[model samples]
Target: MDIRFDGKVAIVTGAARGIGYVCAEMLVESGAKVAIVDILADTLAEAVETLGKKGTVKGYQLDLTKVEDIAPTVSKIREEMGEIDVLIQVAGILAGNPAEKITVAEWDKVMNVNSRSVFFMMQAVTGQSMIPRKSGSIVNFASIAGIRGMKEPLCSAHYSASKGAVVQLTQQGAVEWAKHDIRVNAVAPGGVLTNAMKSAPPEMLKNAIEPIPLKRLSKPEDIAAGVCFLASDVAANMITGQTLIIDGGGAVVGV
Candidate 1:
């Protein structure tokens, strides 16, 4: 498809590395002025250096889990950038501690960063820009774990619960904003090879692969391609409050 995002502006969070990086790269390549946000200053700078030469790409090193740090940054971007045409929320973490063994700190850390921060970011940006313009696309990253129970405990229960909240958050945001023409959707990846998944246990890997018809883990670029489609108007116009599960047909089979 000749999907070109010319004259558009995009903001990708947690873009220092992993899937977020490729999402930013693809958007820039398709002619969008992309701004990458992450807490890791060093990696964010490296990403900027690599992508800056391509288009109007810039980097913001801010803690997404903290609400106070994001507002000024968004305002500054507004002054500098024309408008935020697309918002891709890729900032999250996953750590596994068995349900019975999970700590309060662990649960808070997962929920605070994964679900709470994402909601705040959406509120900050969409309330300021999207609600005003009445036109924007918000793509959230949810996992198959959120869609269904993991065959093995891959991440802490908090991680899965937080992502489940993300699915609902997308729905609420989409339903509330569709009147204004804003589209809020999510993509649930089954077994994408992200930085966090590099250390998955053998049993976990075996279970994850067993259900997939492809019998393979997806690449970051694979998910990025889906993000691109959701961001673009070609694949959908009236699409909102929906989730596209790219699970290699693993999610469809039931006993």
Candidate 2:
């Protein structure tokens, strides 16, 4: 299928690196004018520069932790990139403390960044752009940890909770926005092979990857492909309020 986003404008969060960066690159290559959003100004610049060569791309530095910043930043994006046709919320944080050990502050921080901000950004974008046009696509980041919980040296109770919320948020958005022609979905990645994983202890990495039916970690591009498919009208016009699990078949083994 010729999956192209010829005239679409996409806003991707956490585009400074990892899954978000790959998603932005793919969208641009597919012909969308993409506005990359991240808090890391320097890295965001590098991403824009790298992807700019492929197609129309720009960067905006916005801290998702602060929910207050979501609307204005989205307005700025619409002003600059035109009405948003797609929104991929890949911006998230990880808190690895055990459930009992996790402090209230830590819990709030994780929830704010991983779940709350995603909703507000979607609300802002939908209100300002998508709702008016009555057409758009929204893809969010959920996680296997959220579904099955984490069981490794690093405790991810808070992260799991936040991602669980993200799954529900995506579903709620899809249900409420369907009449407006906005499709909402999510991508759940497991043990992705990113820079962060490369620095992890060998044992930790092994424990993480051994159970996968594929016997491998997911690449950033692997997750990006799911995001792009959900964002592409030609590919996912009828898909909404669902999650595509890109976990190297880890879910099949109940990992």
Candidate 3:
């Protein structure tokens, strides 16, 4: 299917690198005017510069953990890029510590970025743009860790909890906003081979890939394809409150 955004505008958070970056690039390639957001200013600038060559792309450097900053940032994007037609919340963090040893600060940090900010961003964007317009699509980043427990060394209780929150949030948002023609869904990925995963300890990487039926880690493009499908109004018009798992069949084997 040749999905296209044409004249739409999209906001993609955590788009400085990894799966987030690929999603933003695909949106641009599909003809959407994209606002790529990230806390990493330098990296975001580079991404903006590179994506600019392909289509209309802009970078916004804002820390999603700062809940207070979300509303204003959304407002700026609306004013600069036009009312957002699509939102892809991909900003998240994974800190691995045993549940028993997890500090309050560490737990809070993960939740703040992965769960809380996601809610507020949706609230701000929908209230200010989509709700008023009565049309939009949102895709949140969930994880396989959220869907099921993992025995991997890097799986942290807080990270899993945060993603679980995301899954619930996506469902609630989908139901609540369906009246306004807004669709909310999530993509749960397992062991994606992004830059961070590339630098992971050999044992950790091996552990991640061993259980998948496909016996391979997902590429960033793999997850991006799912995200773009969810974000497409035409393609996913009837899809909502769903968590599309792009785990290379790991979930099927109970990994």
Q: List clash counts for every candidate, in order.
A: 0, 0, 0
Q: Is candidate 1 or candidate 2 better by TM-score?
A: 2
Q: Tell me, by TM-score, which candidate is best.
A: 3
- The models' CA-based lDDT, in order, is 0.85, 0.91, 0.94
Instruction: Please write out the lDDT profile of model 3 over residues 79-196, one tens digit for every residue.
Output: 9999999999999997788888999999999999999999999999999999999999999999998998867576699999999999999999999999999999999998899988
Using Cα atoms with residue i matched to residue i, what is each candidate's TM-score against the true structure? 0.94, 0.97, 0.98
- With a 3 Å backbone cut-off (N, CA, C), the pairs that clash in candidate 3 are none
Pitting candidate 1 against candidate 2, the one with the higher lDDT is 2
What tens digits encode model 2's per-residue C-alpha lDDT throughout 83-181?
999999999986677667888888889999999999999999999999999999999999987787577655588899889988999999999999999
Best by lDDT: 3
Q: Return whichever of 2 and 3 wins on lDDT.
A: 3
Model 2: residue 21 alpha-carbon error in angstroms: 0.6
Candidate 2 residue-wise lDDT at 39? 95
